[model samples]
Target: MTMTTDTRPRTAVQLQTNGMGDLVWHAEYFRCIAEQSQGGQVTVIAAPTTMARDLIGHEPWLREVIDFDRRPRNGRRGRHSGLDGLMRMGAELAPKRLDRMVMFSDHPGRAVIVCWRAGIRTKLGYGATWLQRLLLTKAPRIAMYDGPPVTGTYLDATAFAIAQGFCSAPLVPHINVRPDALARMRERLAAWSQPGFALSIGSSEPFKQWGAENFAELAARLARTGAGVLLVGGPSETALAQAITAGIASELRPQVLSLTDAPVADTVAAMSLMRACIGNDTGATNIAAAVGTPAWVLMGARPPLMHDPSRMKMLEGASLADISPAAVEAQVLAGLA
Candidate 1:
């Protein structure tokens, strides 16, 4: 392992490189270390895919969210891959003079190497492989464990932190939307009399998406209860949003609002106002659940996205198409009640 003679601060730094949902899923663990244990903020070195800056930039527990170009993927070499990128990343991190680095990733070797090169005195991570064990400064003795990458891995990390006397408390998932964004969402929803429910209509893949027809049926049923149905997604899902709105009964069409074009922050704010969210397995659903809104995730290709029954409920089927809108609606109604 590499070493540096420069004196480093005691502040702990976390290196994470996952998507938005994964970031949100592990929020509590981050808080446990930064707030509960350190009684101060921790800096986060996050990947672009995590959107850490946009999602949790305002989190009080974080001192900063630094952008980290992740390793290569899809047969193309990334800017931060191999020896050259590793050296560059190390140089960049050296300025922080970090003493401790915690890595939460499936590929722990690269992160461990980078921290070593940066001269971080202590590097903590799960030694899932031989390379990780050889490189990591400290790691929990994890028994044979196979579970969801985001939730299960974090749970193990939390347990390790507790056993090591790093943090005493176990935190729960909590998301904070910008006050301005929340106000905007509140102002927009005020125009309607009915309470709101959100339908997250976006998915990373076609097979993961619950079709427009299914959402339309669910929206119409929820609308009959006099609740406003907000169709939430990104710009790419605008057509899908429109299709779902069109599928609704003509009389209740006014109850459905399209929010596909809304900014991510605004959509997150809107989620807080919802009675509940029925979404496909997507980042939006995770965001909704993190914000304390009950989210029913329609699991198709992916089963058991996370392990927070208090906020997230998984509805799995052989395929996304197999899950009926009626069954989803029933779950949502029950959750709301």
Candidate 2:
């Protein structure tokens, strides 16, 4: 549906309760809102996960980041707890008296309720559900096709908001790393004056992860070229990182450094410093791309077209194992060059 730009709101809230990759995808959406509002206040209502905090907490465009703790509490955990949590969240938000709301989540029923109860006059989101179509003041229909980029699906909501005159700017996904973080990363890696590459080996699911052996071989190949390798991931993947680190030959081990469980800001800063990044189709890879670092993403299960296309070289197969180490090494070498 076409919408005329009318009723510029003074304050707007965005609802995004997904993972880090999704947060990176919505960075453009958030920027569009800020631009259209002409610096009007914007807030993000996100989940309480560490990834959410890391992705949205430091955004300069957002005025606040509210942690919408949806985990079942007070014996309220059940199949119906989602609705219960929504009502409670709405009650909590009603006091804010927001002027507008934009939702990026697929589950819009609860968000629609929240906007209504919060007394937000203008609501915008994807009309994927019955409640969404009935409750949202302006919701653009999203059709899922086989080959469309997932980033396109995300950007469509921004386009809708812009078309409606809620915001007036093009979508640009951005990440702002503090100078101190960048300085610290440089200080830590100063010992290795040569250019470096980031190796991200973790994914939200095991199916999406390329085998550790493959990563080990790739790291060995990169190390042979005298490029420092930074193994990146969360604490949960420490074991995997160690295994990959151990797999590298002793002569090349000095060039491979494991940076497991680093802060998101530091990780992003480190990625920015790298010549290029290679990893599974994971949030860290997305973060790397957002920071202007070229990434070679290994894809499994999902199609390559589902992700952002710019500054990325995707290697897809039926499984991560199907992507051989030699193919990844060639791409890595080309990316580094």
TM-scores for all predictions: 0.87, 0.86
Task: Name the lDDT of candidate 2.
Answer: 0.73
Tell me the tens digit of each residue's lDDT in model 2 across 108-157.
66677777667777777666667667777754565433244546545565
Query: On residues 15-94, what C-alpha lDDT tens digit does candidate 1 reach at each position?
Result: 45466777876676776667532436687877767778778888888888877775533566666778788777888888
Candidates' RMSD to native: 4.2, 4.9
Write down the lDDT of every candidate, Cα atoms only. Answer: 0.76, 0.73
Candidate 1 regions exceeding 4 Å error are 1-9, 15-17, 36-39, 71-77, 148-151, 168-170, 300-302
Q: At residue 300, give the lDDT of candidate 2.
A: 56
TM-score of 1: 0.87
Show the lowest summed lDDT stretch of 10 residues, model 2: 72-81
Backbone clashes, each candidate: 0, 1
Lowest lDDT 10-residue stretch of candidate 1: 4-13
